[model samples]
Target: MDVPFGKPPVERADAARNREALLCTARAMIAELGTEKVTMDGLAERAGLGKGTVFRRFGTRAGIFRALLDAEEQRFQAAVLSGAPPLGPGADPVDRLIAYGRERTHFLLARQDIARAAVERKGPVPAGGPVFTQPHIGMLLKQARLGLPDPETLAFQLTSALEGPPLVFLSMDRSTAEQRAERCQGDLGALLADSWQTLIERLAGR
Candidate 1:
């Protein structure tokens, strides 16, 4: 089968060996140090590979971070999409969305460094289209019976509010990170709910 990135396909044997070595070395380094300390040069030395080879495999520090974040995001998505109530399939939409935001806030707080790096160094290509949060926010608004004049615009606004404050606060002392995240999540959830209610009332009056 053809690869998506225009690279020639690797033979199965070579690919397996390379994958195993890379995973083993990366895990050992991460265990000894931490994700932030796993530099390209350090990883290269540990894996017995050239610096260029390490870069070729992962692109950049952010790329490696994203690879790790991708795993976490997948787990989060699965829980929100399928696992349980409030966060998954068995709750009302508002509850599900609130749960989603709360979980996201907790995750981002825990992985602040990785989250910041991912946001700063976005993927080489945009994932879908001009608006990133439209689908998610639109679904929530629809379920809440919120008739937003422009779902796309409202979605972007809500997403920004949800992600911005905690990131700013988290850059400070580590002692207050959890407290700040909890407060931010509560405030954000309230703002979103109130905003939707006001929009609905205004539309109803018109």
Candidate 2:
């Protein structure tokens, strides 16, 4: 019988052990040395494994970083799905959108280095895919029932504005990450003010 593609066969015990060890070591090295400085050879040496073993495990430095990043992204996505009000299910979609902007600003700031590495490797950044938060924002837009023909496009426009070049350039301006997150909330609120009442009415309809 063929298993479903999303369900992988179980890993062998020893293989699982090696994978865990490698990931643990890699995490430590990333914390100590930063993502770009954490080389494949260094990981293999520190893990006392052959370089080929590291390759078999993760394919490349980019691969390992992607794995680590996916794990982190999953947690953030979970919060948006079910964790709490504003960022989760219990609040109005517009409030949730604001909450999302704040949380994502902080998340991006914290993960900026890994994000930069992903960019360098032409890997997935945190803003483009359905697996990322953009689709969630699109869902919020739909929940608002704004009568827009392309809620996803509006979602893209909003996220791209908040998480785009201006934010990155602002990171160099000496504001703390927390300060930037506050600014994001303020900016988004101001930008969406004209449409805010419409969003509230839509949510109230539900």
Candidate 3:
């Protein structure tokens, strides 16, 4: 069989090395100086590559952050999918939801500066997509066989309640992160308990 020469060849080993170098430098810059201070020029200078090379590798500063955050999100997702109880698979679904909220709240607060950068650049969070939290909650609702009129819609509502921005914003009123997390957990407990009772009543009527 003959191959077409018009197609581009696979990336060369040196090009891959260059890409890895730029990513490594960019991550170090982000850790040392925060996302806002990590610029294309700085990355190029630090990696000993040309500015054009950096831009060609990532397109923009936002693209670099997007790549970094993508890796971080994958690790977080893996933890939720397979790591341990509560946030993983061993606990009740509702308890898992509570643990997820607590951990996600903490994660967002810890990386708030990076998160702010991602938000300003309109990057995606796993929970914000249908591929993650929304589906997880929706499936749990169905598994619980709750008599809610719209399980999917309710799932979105619950997932949104666990989002970082609103939680962080609400905690700004002289509340510590610890206080906010505890308050959120208590609120979730109350909301789920009330909803469960309502669901039971609705099912009894049928």
On TM-score, the candidate that comes out on top is 2
Over the stretch 70-133, how does candidate 1's per-residue lDDT look in tens digits?
Answer: 6667777777667988877778766655666666656655666555444434334212211323
lDDT of 3 by residue, 49-123 (tens): 899988887786766766666666787888989989888888876566656666665654555455445543344
- Per-residue error (Å), model 3, residue 96: 1.3
User: What lDDT score belongs to each candidate, Candidate 1 first?
Assistant: 0.61, 0.68, 0.65
lDDT of 2 by residue, 75-144 (tens): 8888888898988898977778767766776665566566555443444344443346567888888997
Error of 1 at 171 (Å): 7.2
Worst 10 residues of 3 by lDDT: 120-129
Q: Rank the candidates by lDDT, best first.
A: 2, 3, 1
Model 2 error, position 104 (Å): 1.1
TM-score of 2: 0.66
For model 3, the superposed segments whose C-alpha errors exceed 4 Å read 1-20, 119-131, 145-149, 164-206
Pairs that collide in candidate 1 are: none
Off by over 4 Å in 2: 1-17, 120-131, 145-150, 166-206
TM-scores of all predicted structures: 0.60, 0.66, 0.64
TM-score of 3: 0.64
